[model samples]
Target: MLTLFHSPGACSMGIVFLLEELGVDYTLAAIDLRKGEQNDTAFRQMNPKGKVPTLILDDGTALTEFPAIAYWLCRRHGAAELWPDTIDGQARVLELVEFLVASIHMRGFTFLAMPQKFSADPAAQDSLRALGRREVEAGLATVAAQHGAALCARSRIGIEDAALFYILVWARALGIAVPAPLSAYAEALLARPSAQVALRGLAAG
Candidate 1:
């Protein structure tokens, strides 16, 4: 069986949602980020980057990173809908996922939540946070314009939806305002049984 290493309320929850949606039996290993468990030797042996959402395959090979893990699971399970078969459709999903990782999580949330990582000076940290706020707002707008309406209209949830839902969790925690459409879309996703199951996993952790 596969084992997924995750932290509560982290972006790793996206993988949990995907696993629930796929109906795959897997073990959940909760890493307590608050206590710095992710930085420990055991965890580092599995993922040198010391990040959550690390998947240990049945053969014991470890996989890290959201985009790669999501794609791997979708393909391994033959869930084509989650990751379209066609080049163009697959590209679109990847584009959205990468944008969320790069523009939103890396450039926006990381700076906003942990500005000290970027600079030591207090003034620079404040400026970085302000910039993160702007980037987050702009990123949400882009997501709203690109995928919000389509995601809400679709009956089946996809990989991109899982990723977007996770990002919204961070947005809410940071008190960042999302676009109106995305706000509604978030409600829709949360109502799904799969999303609820994933949330329960996080809460239980």
Candidate 2:
């Protein structure tokens, strides 16, 4: 069985949702990031980066990063619809996933977690946040344009879509504004049974 060290509503929830979607049995170890549990030495040993959503493999090793973790889980469970069987297909999914990670996720972390690094002056900080908003809006627009097309249904919730969903959820939790198309796509995805279960599980915990 796999063990997931996750913080509720964090990017780790994406993996939880995927596990639920795949019907894979696993253990959930909640790490309360708000209380600094993630910084504990034991947790740091699991993920040197001190991040939530560290996945412990059956062999007792750990896996980090959204795209890589999702890829491994999908392949391990033989869930082709959520991963893809062919090399080209997997490559395309990974390509889009990387785009989300490099562009959207990075910007989110910078704005939300490291606001001080962007600017010292209050006005400058506000300016940076506004810029971050525009960046997030543009990124989500791109995601909607790229993933909301009819072609997306052919692939289902593959790696790109999964990562895209994770970013959208994270942004919303932080009160970041989102455009209609992206919001709609996220809402539709969240309406799925697996997603609801993952969310409710987090709420319950």
Please provide, for model 2 over 1-205, each residue's C-alpha lDDT reduced to its tens digit, 9 standing for 90 to 100. 9998888777788888888877789999989877989899998988999986789998999998877888888888845466566889777777778878877777854575556776798888877777766777778777777766543455366555567667877676667765666666677777788777666545431
Q: Estimate the TM-score of every prediction.
A: 0.93, 0.84
Per-residue lDDT of model 1, residues 15-128, tens digit only: 988888888889999998889999999999989999988999999999999989888888787455666779999899899999998789989988888899879999999999
lDDT of 2 at 129: 74
In candidate 1, which residue ranges exceed 4 Å CA deviation? Answer: 201-205
Full-model lDDT for every candidate: 0.85, 0.74
Instruction: Assess candidate 2 and give its lDDT.
Output: 0.74
Per-residue lDDT value at 150 in model 1 = 85
User: Where's the lowest-lDDT run of ten residues in candidate 1?
Assistant: 196-205
